[model samples]
Target: MIKAILFDYDDTLVQTRKTRYQTIYKLSEELFGTKITEKEIDAAWGLPAEEFLLNLFGRFSSDIHYLWSIYIEFSKKDLNIPHLNAFDFIDKYKNFVKFGIVTSSSEKVVLRELNELRVDTNLFLQIQTSDHTAVHKPNPNVFEPIFALLKKENMNKEEIIYIGDSPADYESASKFGFHFLGIAHDDRHTSYFQTGEIPFVRNFLELEEYLIDQYSFI
Candidate 1:
């Protein structure tokens, strides 16, 4: 009786790690004349934007805004197509449960990518982003807004699922009382969930199967 599903936008819904790595690589080279390596980016992956920058540069500066602008422009060129039948998955389950986007990304970034992918935003019951919440992931309060929304719909916490790709996503959702499903896209993500004994699926096809078989959604 899962009544709602809250999705993490970036790595979960769309394939963004490469695009993000490229953006950071090019930005570092263009501005600071430093070439950031993929290994470095991977280490900082899934961190909040500011924290990601801090982890990379080891310092905070006004240039973070400049970097963000360039990142957004680069992202505009990246289409960031939905991963593994994500649009199809949404369409298939929209009637079965309320769909929402609960992400640590800003609305500006999320909306642009969603538009570029041609996803029908109307299909979601809500799209809550970092801009909509005071705190971000790893902080359980980040889920309060959506939790409240579900409560208003008379949905129980046990009946809501939050699908994401990072340990932080799982931590926050589980702490906030929602079931969490990891959407592991690579060995790194896979290992994280496996180590934590968390349930996950590699792609939307697996997700579709998991939902039907485990939840009797069919």
Candidate 2:
């Protein structure tokens, strides 16, 4: 029986595609003096911000902070774009199933968005954010603490499932032996995750269908 469900932030629970696009576009122009296309932003979206910056510009880049600051400032303003249907749908399971959120976003930003969106933070049993771990998604370290927490709750990996909208999220779940559900928050990102043949749903309504079909209610 499933005892827990973990969710990913950003596109998985909220709409941040335009915010990501704008941030990457501005950073590309300012940092590299060249513009990045929408495809580039989608490809880099799964990567940690600093890791993506270093991978693209290497260690010699002088203003990585400037790029990140601009990105965060713009992203913060994007909190008002709400997608609460997923939360409402999940609430049915929330009563009997433990809920947690694991995301690459920083704690402050996630909290700000949650409050602005009127999402009660207390609904989740745990919320793991970027600031909580040095390593980000696609790396198991970010999820290690989460697993430990669930383990302490007497839930094994098989009893927990992860739902996310990015390749990193899928990869990490696979590496750690958790069942994974992918959401096509963005076509391009979903395409990337689909390459691995992970199961997917386009929206929370579809997700509700999936849960009804694949999982039994407690």
Candidate 3:
């Protein structure tokens, strides 16, 4: 039986494409006076947000630190990120399966938005942020800790489904031997979804139904 459900944040559990794009565009304009196109910004969606900004603002990681800090301050103001309502489904099955989050977003940024939305971070069994590991997703190393944690719970990768909205998440699940459920509304990973090799849900509500019907065997 399935024993755990791990999720990707940002565009997966919460709607963040617009906010992420706007903040990056704003920061790009402020730092280099160049307005980055949506296509340019979308190209960097699944990677580490800081590293993405670093490349855009120039290779100087040192400069990215300061610029990203300023950008964080700007992000917290009026960020209208909507909770995707998938949490209720998670909570419904809370007693039977472990629910957790693993995301490329930094702890500060994720926690800030979670708090601002009054969402409880403690709902998950474990929340792994970008700061938790040096290697990012699509790298099997990033999921080693999660695998170990689930092992402690006596669950195998086959009994866990990883839900996300990015190619990185897709590859991570494939590499790590977990079932992957792609969410498509973000459209950030649309090209990756074009293959239809993996199962996908267009929105959280559909995902909830999928989990309820498909994994009810748990």
Models 1 onward score TM values of 0.90, 0.81, 0.89
Per-residue lDDT of model 1, residues 1-218, tens digit only: 78888899888898887577776777677766887888888787766666676677654345777657767776676567678888898998788789999887777888888887788999888899867877888999998888888899999999999999888999999999998899987776788888889999988999988987887764
Estimate, for each residue in 47-87, the C-alpha lDDT of model 3 and write its tens digit: 78677666566543467778677778767764847656666
lDDT of 2 by residue, 7-33 (tens): 998788887665556655666676568
Candidate 1 achieves a global lDDT of 0.82
Superior by TM-score: candidate 1 or candidate 3: 1
Error of 1 at 203 (Å): 1.2
Best by lDDT: 1
Please say which candidate is ahead in TM-score: 2 or 3. Answer: 3
**Whole-model lDDT values for every prediction:** 0.82, 0.76, 0.79
TM-score of 2: 0.81
**Segments in model 1 whose C-alpha atoms lie over 4 Å from true places:** 50-65
State model 2's lDDT.
0.76
Of the candidates numbered 2 and 3, which has the greater lDDT value? 3
Error of 1 at 48 (Å): 3.0
